[model samples]
Target: MDNTTLVDNANVVATPNGVLPLAASVELVCSSRTFVPFLFVFCAIYHFLAPLYTTPKQLSWILTTVASATMTLVSIPFVWDYVSSGGDVKSVRTLSSLTYATTRMFQAYLVSDLIMGSIYYRNQLMLLTGWFHHILYVFIVQICIKRAWTQIFCLCALMELPTFLLAISCLYPRLRSNVAFAVTFFLTRILLHLIWCISYLIPSNRTHTTGGSILPSVMLAGVFPLHAIWFKGCVKGFIKRRKENRALAPQAVTVDAVALAHATIPSSTSDSYISFRSASHNHPARKDYSLSTLHHIGYRLWPARKAIYSFVGLGRQTSS
Candidate 1:
């Protein structure tokens, strides 16, 4: 009856209630049109905060970690609603304003990272892998949003859970040894992704009775292989790193955590730890992340601890 029949789903014109009146304006605002503006915005913000991190990598990690956490958290309620309602058609075909805004914002962030990484953090970016991944996501997210695949997009966003952990660990390498990252990565990216794909493959799946478009399904299935490949490589790398760590004796190749932090961390980050070792309690020269700081604190607390222990021993003897 309207442009609804004439127009395609590639634009955000179609909704559960038929053709949306402000669809064009809203789409333009929430679509890839914001990419350039967001790019400039993120670039300016990161440059402003760059001095705090000392390196593009650390700054980039801070942005991505926050973005990933935000997207994951924001998607949870929508995703939970979709799943709990048993894949209502409205949840899939209907695009909400919040989901649209969140998707576009995250897309802008990813686009900014790709462009900025190319110019500033080229050394940190993987040639083929990173480029292909970001490009694919940036391109696909727009299409998915346009086609109103918010539920599937939200489900896929859970994979970023691992990125939050890994990205934060870049600044704090001591937590890098934790197996939680690898485990979460495998669970979300590999196992959960595989299940989603299988459900998509199943015809007439009651549990996920949303859309049945082959193209969207194909697009989703495509990412599973990439996830699997990344997981495999991650596991191998984790194993190798652990083996190397086990082979080395304690502090054999390294000094204390402070020295290790200095040797490995960017100078900008380490120098910010002023009050860590300052005796005057004012801003004094000291490294916060170190073994000696732990020893110093423990040494200062030992007398009180001994006194408490002696009191407990005396109480126990009196009871006996």
Candidate 2:
């Protein structure tokens, strides 16, 4: 297809053969903003349905509610613009200043947020449905009709607010470490997204609009499953270790109690013998070394060596 036709299909006005022009290839950018509320409703419903997924507590719910309400409120103007524009690309620009820059910047944040939200909720969303969102997005982009950047960003921003809310909950001390880890891991993936944004500002890359779209799709496909697999593996390992600990804990406590009693009783008994010997003889010079002396010494020493042996299975004779 000629550059003009390709640009038209992307719903972008062609720039003078540059990266910014290619970035404009993300047509329908603000078009997706129209559907943001519906996406939020879906996420809220999804959050409730999956018990396996973590849910926000009451305080978190308040924060989520407030943030969501604000985001929804801000969309009023954009929605009005969208409705008044009648879905025409030119009409949208007529109503808005720096329409291209505004849309692409939003697109960059939205698309990256969508991919990250999918990663965050993979267990809850995919565990039962096995990645319905991934399949759905694929179908929409490849078969239903080509998606514009507007649509992608709107859907993304819709999903992101909830994920960010969840992240806020995880920032508590108990979960802060894991939250930090997830944040760091998620940031690495955004580098690719940042590239997508930068490509839009440059002109040389516009010739192959498909290249930009394909990069995100390929990255997400690989990342989503990789996250799912890693999460599943971690869950499995955790369950296995917990079961083993349950079995081992009681026995360990019993063994400790018995060992402690055995350890204390002998020392006390030995102390009594020494007291009796000293009282009866009035001095060590008059006391005879009896068979009991040898036995009592051996018994007390046995407990110490046995404790060492049980800990790491060291042989008693090793010290000898």
Instruction: At residue 127, give the lDDT of candidate 2.
Output: 39
Count of steric clashes across candidates, in order: 0, 11
Off by over 4 Å in 2: 1-147, 156-166, 174-222, 244-320
lDDT of each: 0.65, 0.41
TM-score of each: 0.64, 0.25
The TM-score of candidate 1 is: 0.64
As for model 2, its CA RMSD to the true structure in angstroms is 21.2
Which candidate wins on lDDT?
1
Worst 10 residues of 1 by lDDT: 263-272
Expressed as tens digits, the lDDT of each residue in 1-320 for candidate 2 is 44544445443465556433444454344435533543454455445543533443422233233344444443445445445866322222222333333333333333333443454543333432334544544343332123333332332233333344444444343543443444533442243334334443334433233333454345344445654554455457668877997787656645533443344323344454554444334433222234564355335534344444544656455555
